[model samples]
Target: MSSPNGASEKQSEQSEAISSRKWFARGARAAISIPAFILTAAFVGYAGLARETGLTLLETLAMTGFIWALPSVVVLTGALSSGMGIVPAGIAVALASVRLMPMTMALMPIIKVQGKTKNWQLLIASHFVAVTAWVYAMKHLPELPREARLPFFVGFGSSISTFVFVLTGIAYLLVERLPDVVAGALFLLTPVYFLCSLWGAARLNADKAAMVAGLVLGPVFFISLPGLDLLWTGLMGGTLAYLATRIWRRGLS
Candidate 1:
């Protein structure tokens, strides 16, 4: 009947299909979680802030839809209103997004999605890109089958985008009705949720090292260089963490 090779090929294809389905399932779970809910609240706060700061609703929505990066949007909007040149505002936006490069590198291996197909997925995925989704993917993808990674990412990304779209619209309309305290509390959700997620996800020596380095360096760098604080803190702290890990591993060996 069937040759062994043919049977093996069929089995491999089936395995891949199964893996893809599992990835999507995991992503669906994350999409409906507390963290995702917090992200939506934070987006609402961002929309309110944009309106309060005199940005047009259309501009705010455009930023949410296209930029999809909160910190960058904040910096760009603030810089523009402060009379900064367009070039400087653009640079500020780019600098704020530098963290994504490291995030992308960390996720590339876990995703294991390859070639031209992956390119298109990446383009679509970038629209919903944010710190939360990246952290979730990094934490969960390694434990999943290879074929599922893309689907999982798609699910999580789509969830975040959908929530941002609706919540942002709501925030724009309701900003005036919401109390200042409530708006401030909503704005705090993103950072708090991110720190909690980071703590929960820090399973390895490298993660611990990085966290410690960031804790020590972030405040110091922030006081010294307000505008470039994140960039400098991340670079210096991450490098120190890497060096420390290497030294400790060598000593153990």
Candidate 2:
């Protein structure tokens, strides 16, 4: 017969696994209910953007799976097609993903599956840490048990990521068939939703400041700097905003 403590430990493990499954199932339901497809519409624009920048449908679809972030995909694809070499293109893509740094930091703690996931698995899961999944996870993960959060997020993210990858190919194929006006409208939807999500989720004074600076300086920098505008706009504008908010907070304190 098994020792009493051995049986108890096994029982506990089984209970945790069962609970994790329940949470994972809950996450799937939530993913369906939230209608994650609407957000992936941005990838449709991404597909169109990639094609306009000279990527074939297959290459664009590969990007949707590998790059996995819309802004990064757009930035890198645009640069590559413009004849920018791999080094410069890589730098530009990295700069565009600077925002994801903080998001991943906040999300990792909530979604980390300690003792269960390998390091490579965590790294792969981190790639799925984009705006839509982050927002949905942040809003819903708290309601779940610690054992379940990671599984739930993995399930939820896997579902949406797969959908996005598939649809990007479809969009590339269909963009040429759609009316020009409809195509243009579809392309704008992602950015519009991005801006709204940023505003809604911003909690810090610095975040608001960055947005203000980006809007104010983005066009000005574009006119002045030409090809390097986005990079400069982010560096100068984000830096100034950070400085301003730090100073303001210190003064108040």
Candidate 3:
């Protein structure tokens, strides 16, 4: 049998554990609404748009859960629907995915455990760093404790993903039931959400400049090339913005 002191210590540990769980749950819930409203609009559009592309609900869900990047999903579905060959279509998807690299780099560091978290864990964690998650995490994670950040993010992001996943399916199913104009309006939500969020969240001159360049060039490229516009727009716009920012910083130095 344990001593009185040992029994009291065990009770204290249990109480502490319960309190930690409550604290973490509260933090996670706080993070949820950060992206919920914006992504609800965007993914509703994506779902309707995906249905138009003739992608099955399973395919839509797979893209949302596995790829988790809206722009890449748009590129892949468009290329596939256009009857592009698999290799070329894949290349286009890969090109669209390139933009996610910067988002990942900017976000994963916030929740990483350095030596404690393995490289593969970090790689898997990086997949969840999409535009919605990245923007919300960057905006809100600072208010959370270091230890609670990852769990809070996992809870918050998983809820958002699940919500969007279900909404996408529902929107896809409802697209036909709704009138044409309403469906079309739904399809436009993602870009509008992205435009507003990027501008609202941009903290640097370079970030604002890049977003403005993308905003201007995106329409031109879409008009010029139709379905393949996202690939070229991302590559060219991102490259130009990065180079221009680096040059400006160097000149300042």
Candidate 4:
């Protein structure tokens, strides 16, 4: 027969496990929302684009599953289609994906448990830290228990990722049936959502400043330095915003 302490510990473990499952289920259900739908729509456009770019269905699905970011997919597909070699295409994809690093960083503190959350868990969770999932987490995590946050995010992220993956295949098969205008419009939805989300979620004036600076410089750089426009825009715009913020703070003090 088990001792009373052993029984009590076993009961506690079971309760914790049940609670984790409940949170996971809640997150999966939450995946059926506007942002997730927007992500799905973006993948529809990605599917069509992939087809047009001569990628096989398998390749399209592989990219969706592995990359999981619309911008990275676009950059990789664009580079490959333009006859850029694998090395250059990979570099372009890496550059496009670098923007997500901040999102992952912002989320770490929110979901991390002081002693309970393991590094391996975080390493896995970080892979799912894309735009839609990060935005959802920011909106909902504070209301959740710290222990529940990681499971909830993994559930939400995995659910939406799978949902998009399936739809991307369907869209790929159906792209020939979709009109060019419709496909193009669908493909543009994600970036629009992305911009709106950033503006809405920005906590600091400096964040907004960087965005505005990027907007103003984007067109100018596109015309003058099309090849490295994005890189230059991000570097210059972010630097300008940082300097401005510092100057404003110094003046206030």
Candidate 5:
């Protein structure tokens, strides 16, 4: 009979294999699910809003393709509508995208592919790097092997991009018929989805602490400081959470 340790090792190996397969499967499904459709709808709304607000179609598509961020696109559109200068619009967009920096830092270590392959992966990833894909990858990629991680992310990202392209076209064409109430409701999904997913991903102690801190601090900061609220809230909440976790761990050790 196998030793208990050997049996445990075998089980762990099997579990890892199963998890890898599941990640791959999830990558494929995410590329073609209701969630994907919802994400695509959000992008489509961005394009339609841009057109209605007098931005060119090329500019709209360029933002979707390059920025790949909804909040930034919305800020840009709103700024343009308000007769803001291109420089200020661009600054607002960049500020909104700063949230992705932390997300990328957390994800890179998990999905670090090397060599020419990594170069290609990065090229494809830039176009697909939106909120949904980021959330999905952060939650699932840790269980995946380094070799499989790139393919899984590429698949997931590509799927979202493809859907977004189609949805953007649809939104551009149907902008007139869509009611403002419906459009506003659809727009709410982006933030709701991100917040809910972020909360759900807080399985670790550090994540839970950071999330709780952010939730508590975000609104309070917003009330006190309107323009710089998100930046300050994230910094304070994340820093406090990190310090608290460190102290707790030190005490335990």
Candidate 6:
């Protein structure tokens, strides 16, 4: 009963759906990696922090699901524990999350499918542009068809985010039994994992230079300018690396 054009459209829709589902499954499987485990462990530490800050079960769960970034969650918790006002706490959390903006910017072009991918879809995908997901996407997305990249990243990010969210609730209940030192150490895992992952995955000399510069500058800034240490370290280290790499390239040329 359907016209030829209608049948072709239906068939094309079905094919697109099948491709998305297949890539989604593959992305979910890819989520079972060391970075995922490190992220989950980081959430375990967040659970303890949430409990110590007097957050209720519902609040803890909500923060885990909504904020979804350990550093931002930590900033919010720290602000609340210190009796900071809501507006200030929000600003602090936003600042902490600002680091993800560059990651999202780097990833958007990789996953975007020219005219076919919608801006709204990319917007949704940007929410999952954490360090772990960004690294995985950068490494794997090139291998996938352009159309599959967006769904694949969304699937991986959603699955990993959900997995951590559930584990955070369970960890919250068990956090009381964990030693303070152990919980703090658990929170440290993610940054260590992040640095190692970037170092290993980096393909360019500039990337390595930035890492080295950051490491060397981090402690110096922490001691001399504790309040703005992170800001200074990132700014100075990244600029230094960029200039150094450019100079080196020019000299070679």
Q: Report every candidate's CA lDDT.
A: 0.79, 0.77, 0.75, 0.86, 0.75, 0.84
Candidate 1 wrong stretches, greater than 4 Å: 1-26, 114-117
Which predicted model would earn the best TM-score? Answer: 6
Indicate whether candidate 2 or candidate 3 has the larger lDDT: 2
Sort all candidates by lDDT, best to worst: 4, 6, 1, 2, 5, 3
**Candidate 2 lDDT over residue span 147-203, tens digit each:** 778878877887788777877787888776556776688777766766776676666
lDDT score at residue 160, model 4, on the 0-100 scale: 95
Question: Local error of candidate 5 at 1, Å?
Answer: 46
Residue-level lDDT of model 6, residues 62-170, one tens digit each, is 8878877777788887887799997888877876786687678778888998888888989888888887888888878988889899989998999999999999899
Candidate 4 residue spans exceeding 4 A from truth: 1-6, 204-206, 217-253
Clashing pairs in 5: none
Question: What stretches of model 5 exceed 4 Å from their correct place?
Answer: 1-29, 114-120, 123-127
Instruction: Using lDDT, give the best candidate's number.
Output: 4
C-alpha positional error of residue 194 in candidate 3 after TM-score superposition, expressed in Å: 1.8
- lDDT (C-alpha) at residue 109 in model 4: 93
lDDT of 1 by residue, 60-129 (tens): 8888887887888888879867989978888888888888778777777667556524676666765555
Better of 3 and 5 by TM-score: 5
lDDT of 2 at 189: 77
Error of 5 at 74 (Å): 0.5
Model 3 lDDT vs. the true structure? 0.75
RMSD for each model, in Å, please? 3.4, 3.8, 4.8, 3.0, 7.4, 2.7
**Lowest summed lDDT window (length 10), candidate 3:** 26-35
Model 5: ten consecutive residues of lowest lDDT: 113-122
